[model samples]
Target: MTFDVPDASYYGALITNDSFEILVRKNANTGEGLFLRWPHDSDTRPDLLVQSCLDKEFGVNAQLIEGYDAIVFIKGGSLVNFIVHYLGGDIEAVGLQWVTLKTAWELVFKLEDHEVLLSDSASLGVLDRWIRNRRRKIAEESFDGEQKKWLEKFDRLCDRVRYVLGRDSACYGGDGLYSEYIKSIISSAISTMKEQEDLDLYLNDLFGRTSKPGRSAAREADLIQAIHVSLALSSLDLYNAEYTNHVKECRRVLGFLVALENIYGSSSLEIRRRAIEGGNGRWRGHDKAGRIKSDQIKVGQVKSIESAILKVLEDKKLYRKSDRVDVIAGKIAGAVQGEISTLGLGDFFVDKDLQLFIWHFISENKVARGLIK
Candidate 1:
C-alpha cells in the first residue's frame, strides 16, 4: 500500500506552548476521530519529531532527543497504518533513513585518518535502538518479508564497503589486477558478517532461527579480500625493485656505448698505438696493428655492436644467468678480435685479443638493464 505524508509544518503550527485544548472531531457514523495535541515545547516540535524519526530509522544517532523516543513512537503505531503520516509517506521515511545510513557509512570509511564517528558510544546506542525497533516490527504479524530482505541487502552493502576501506592488511597473492578484484569479494564477506549479526538477534527472537556460530561464506570473502590486497601491495614492491634494477642497467649500457664510440671514432694508427702501450713491451706489427685500429667504420658500426650486446643481454635464453653484462661483453670482444685478424693489422695491433676482450668487458659491465629505461 502507498502512503501520503502529512504537512508537518502545518501540524506543528497547530501545537502551542499554552497547552490549550485541541479538538478531536469524530465522525459518528464511521467511529473515527482526528486526535490533535500541541507540541510539548519549542524543542519538541513536529520537525524535531520528524528528524528524530529519521535518525532512529536509519540506525544513526540524532542529537534532537535524549534517548530513543522517536523510534518508540514509530514502532508504537498500529499495524494498519504507521504513524508515518505525522511525518510523511513510507517511501520518504524509508528513503531518508537509507540516505542517512549510506552517508554515515561513507563518512566512516572515507576518513581513513580519523576514527569512525558512527562507532562512537552515543551513536552505537542509537543504532542499537534502531535495531531493536526493527526487530520488534519484524516480530509483528504485519511484517513484510520482502521489505526485510531489502533492508538486509542495504545493510550488507554498507558493511562490506566499510570493512574494505577501514581495515589495513593483505589476504593473498596474485596478479595486481586480479588481486584487487578478489580483495573486493573479501570485503563483501566481512561486511556481510557485521550485517548478519545485527539481524541474528531479531531472527532468533521472531522465528527461532539461530545463525551458526562460526566463520562462513562471509568470513571467507573477507579473507580473500585481505589476500588480494596483500598480493597487490607485494606486486607493487616487486615492480619497483625491477624498475630500479633496469635504471642501473641502462646507465651501465650508456657508459659502454660512450666507450665503444670513442674507440671506433679513433684512427687505426692511434688504436694500434694504444693497444701496443696497453700490452706494455709486447711486439707490434704495422699491418696487423693498422688493421686492428682501423677507424674507417661508420656510425652503424657502434650502433650494431651496442644493439647486438643489448639484445643478447636482454634475451633470457642467451644469458640464463642473472649477470647479463659480463657474458655479452666477453662474447662480443672475442668476435671483434677474430674479425680484426682478417683485416691484416694483426702485427701492429699488439695483444689484439686481450685488448678487445678488455674493451668488451668494460663496455658490457658499464651499465645494467635494471638501471636503464
Candidate 2:
C-alpha cells in the first residue's frame, strides 16, 4: 500500500562522493517557499510528487530537474524504501544512513507530527512508541535471522572441513573453544552472557578507566577482525580466537563469507583459500577484501583530535547543559567526525549535526544489558 494522506517533505540535492552534501534549503517549510520543499501525497507516484513539489516551490518556469540523485529521509518509516523502489529505474541512492534507538525515540517525541498523516490520535500515544520500537526490533531480529542461517551454514562447513565426526551441528555453539571464541566477538551469541560481578571484575582489571575507545582503535580493531574472518573462512586459520570470534560477527562486518558463498558458490571459498596461502606472512588475497565503512583515524592524528575534542566538550552547553555530559557527547561526536572526515564524508553535515548523528548511532547499534568478565 501507499501513503493515503498529503504530507510535507523537504527535497534537496544529494551529492554522492568522497565528500557529499545534501544541499538543503535552510527553513525549508517556512512561508514564501523559496526552497525546494513541498507536498507528498499518499496515492501519488514519486515523479508526480517531484514535479509538483518543484512547480509549487519554484515557479511556473523552473527548469526541468534531471540527472540528480534523490534523498527521501522520513521520520521512522520505510517510506524511504517505497520512494526509492517506486521512484523508477533511473533513480539511485546516494548514500545510506542509520540512526540510534535513542535518536529514534527522540525524533518520535520531538518531531513526529502525526496529524498530517494519521487521523487517529490514539495511534500516536503508546501505539506510536510500540510501532517505532517494533520497527527497530524487527530490523534487528531480521539481521539475526540472516546471521542464524549463515551460522548454520558455517557449522556445516566445520562439520565437513574440520571433520568433527558425528557431532550435531546444533551443538557447535556449545563447544568450549567455540563459545569462548564466539562470545568474545558475536556479542549477542549468548543472551545472558554475564552478570554484574563479571563486569566489575573486567572493569576493575582496567583500573576504572572511563575513556572511551578512540575511532582509530576501533578502526584498527575492525580491520584486523575483517582479515581474521576472511582467513578463517578460507580455512587459513580457524583455531585462532580472532577468526573464531569474527565468523559470528557477520552483521558488524556487513555480510561475510557466507554471503559470498551464496552468490559465487563454493568456488568463492576455494578462491579465498588460494588468496590466503598466497599472502603468506603479509596481508593479501581475500584477507584484504572489504573495509570498515567509516574512515579510520591514524596514530599521528590522535594528538590533533585530543585537543580539538577537549575544546568542544569544555565550551558548549546549548542543550545537554553539563560540562561532563558535553564532554562525553563531544568525545562521541569527535570520534564520529573523525570517522566521517577520514571517509571523506565531512560535507554531509556541520559539527553540531555530526555530533547528533554519532549520539544516535551509538544508541541504536549497541545495547549492553549486563556486565561481562
Candidate 3:
C-alpha cells in the first residue's frame, strides 16, 4: 500500500528535541564507509556487527543516501562519546560536538558539516531549499489573493505533518523540499499518524517479504523512491530489534533467576523478582539464614566461581579438566562479556540480569550449538 506522506515538503522542516554527539567510524577495509553499529547483538558471530541506517532506514518509501555515525552510550556518563577509529591508529573524536536531531535529519536533505563525508547527492537540502525559496518568492510577488490564500493553507497542512511526525523545531528541514513522488495523507483528514510501534511492526513484516517495491521499479526516480522506503522501513526494524532484544534479556534474566533459586536454594527471591521487574534501588545485604544476598548473584563453589562452572562442563562430559578453574574461567569471562554489555545495574538490566544472560548464552552457544557433549 502506498503511504501518502502528508506535506512531504514539510517533513523537511520537522525538528527533534533530543540530540547527541557520536563517532562516525570510517572503515578502510571495505573502502565503502564507516562501520556503523548494529541494533541487535548476534548469537552466531557475537563479534561481527551488522546493519546500516544510512543505506535503508527512512522506510521503504523514502530511501536517500546518508552517512551514519557510530553512536555509543555508556552508563553514568554525561557525554556519549563519538569517535572515528581507524584500525591503523588514526582516531578522530569528531570534536565531541553536539549534533541536533535536525542536524542528523539534515543528512537526508543536506549535511552542513564540511569534515563529514558527503554522498553524491548530499546537496538535496540546498537544491530543495532553493526550489522552495523560489516558489515562495513567486507566490509573494506574483500570486493573486486567492493563490496567496492557498499557500497559507499549504503552510498549515505542513505544520500538521510536522506534528504527526513527532518533530520539534530542532529537528531539520526548517526549509521546504517539494517531493513530487511520494503521496502524503492530508493534514486535517488524518485522524491519527502511524505510531512508532506500528512503524516497527510494518518494517519487520516488510523485511521478511520478498515482494517488489510498492512503486514501479522501472524508472530511475521510482527506483530511488524504493530505496528511501527500504531504508525507512529497515531503520524501524533495527530500532524495534534493540528493544525486543532488551525485553528478551529481561525474560532470560527472569528464567535464570528462577533456575538459580531452585538450584541455589533461594537466597534472595525477593531481590531477584525486583530486579526482574525493574531496577529501582540496591539489593544487598544477607538473608535470615546468613547467606550472601545482594545486587550480584554468584553461582560457584564457595571459594571459586570458576571451579564451579568448570565442573558443570566436566559433569556434562563436555571436557575433561583438572581442578584448575582459571582455564575455563578465561573462556567463560569472554562469553559473559559478550552478553552483559555494561557492568553494574542499568535501567532494566541488573547483575542478576547478566547472570541469566550468561545462562542462556551457554545453553545456546554450547548445548544448542552442539559444540560440546
Candidate 4:
C-alpha cells in the first residue's frame, strides 16, 4: 500500500498578556487530546503565517517575538515539516484556553503511553522550547535593572573564556585540559572573592580573557583567562541569588560545583577551601567555624552519596543541608541500587553511610557557633 504523509505544518506559542500563560487546545474529537499548538499547512504564505494562525485560531492579532528554524519530523514513512513561532498577547480562541506552563506540561507530557497527546514531534518541540525560553526569560527578568548593561559585558567575558579554552559555554565538567582550566578559573575566582569586602566594586572591571602569545606568557595568559571565567561565573551566582531573592541560582556555577565536588568529594580540604571561602555573597552565612563533623568518614569516601546530597543543596550554599534529607537519601539509594545491577559497589556501602554523612554534614553546617562553643 502506497500512502503519502503531509509535507508541511506550522505551530506557535501564543503567550498571554502577563506572559505567565500560553494558549493551548484540547481536541474533543481525538479523545480530548491536549495540544499547546495551532494547526498549519504548506499552502499558507510565509509572510502571513502568524497572522493566518491568529485568524484561524483566535481572530486577533498579536506581537511576533521570534521564529525558530523549521523542524522536520518523520511519521508513518513520510517527512512532515513544522515552523515554530513564539507569539505574545491576549486572545479568545475557540476550543482553546490559556494555561500555565506547569498545567500545560502536566496535561501534555505527564500522560500514559496510550494517553500521550503530544506524540507528534511538532507539539512536543514547540512545548519544550517554549517552556525553556520562558524560564530563561523569567530568570533574566530577575536581573537588576542597573546591572543589566554590566551583566551583558560580563557575559561577553565569559564567552571569550569559553572560546579561548575551546570549550562550549553551554557545557561543564569534562575530562580534559579545558575542564581543568575551567576548574582553576572558578577556584581562583572564589579565592579572590573572599578578601574583597565590597564584592560589587571588585567585580566591576574589564579584565582580559585571552593570553598574550608565546610560551613565556602562556602561564600569565592562562591566569588572566581564569580570572575572567571565574568572575563571570561568580557574578552570575551572586546576582541571581540577590535579584531572585535566593529563589534561583546560576545553573552553570551550580553545575560546576557539582562536577567539582563529584571529582574531589565534598570533604576534600582543597575543594572546601576553594568553594566555601572568599566573600562570595552566595556562600554567606555558612557555618565555616566548624570542620566536617564526620570523624569516621574522610574525603574520597562515598562520593556518590555526597554528590546526591549536593544535588539537594542546589538552593543553598556550601555545607548547608537541605530539609529534604530523607528524600535525598532515598534518591541516592535508588541510584546506587540501579547501578548495583551493572557492576556497581552496592555491597561495599549501605544506607547507614548516607545517613551518617548527612548527620555529619548537618552537624558541621547547621549547628550554631554558640552551641559549638
Per-residue CA lDDT of candidate 3, range 136-202, in tens? 6754686566545544543443332222221211223332212221112222112122443586575
Q: What lDDT, from 0 to 1, does candidate 3 have?
A: 0.28
Candidates sorted on lDDT, descending: 4, 1, 2, 3
For model 1, how does the per-residue alpha-carbon lDDT over 127-223 read when each residue is reduced to its tens digit?
3234334434543345355534433432343232322222211211111122222345445544544565565563334222112232233432333
* TM-score of each prediction: 0.18, 0.23, 0.19, 0.33
List ranges where model 3 is wrong by over 4 Å: 1-124, 138-142, 166-183, 186-373
Question: TM-score of the candidate numbered 1?
Answer: 0.18
- lDDT (Cα atoms) of all candidates against the true structure: 0.31, 0.30, 0.28, 0.40
Cα-lDDT of candidate 4: 0.40
Scanning candidate 2 in windows of ten residues, the lowest lDDT window is 364-373
Question: 1-373 in candidate 2: lDDT tens per residue?
Answer: 3333223353221111111111222332232111133344568664456555544443222222231121223333212211211121111231123232222222222222322111111111212233333443443464455554444445444332211111111111222122222323333312222433585464343322212232232333333344234324333223232344545443323332232222222233333222222212222322223212223434334333333444443433421231122123323453546654764554545224344333322222222001000
1-373, model 4: which lDDT tens digit per residue? 1122233443444344444455556542354345433446457643355556666666645554444443322222222223224353344436667665445544543333322322332344344454445544665697676556555544454444432332211222221222333445666667677777976665443122122222222333334433444444556455654544221323433333333333323444544432322212122343433333343444554455454444444533222132222222322333434443344434444323333234334323433212222
CA error at residue 197 for candidate 3, angstroms: 31
Off by over 4 Å in 2: 9-82, 86-148, 151-357, 360-373
Q: How many residue pairs clash in all the candidates, one count each?
A: 36, 4, 33, 3
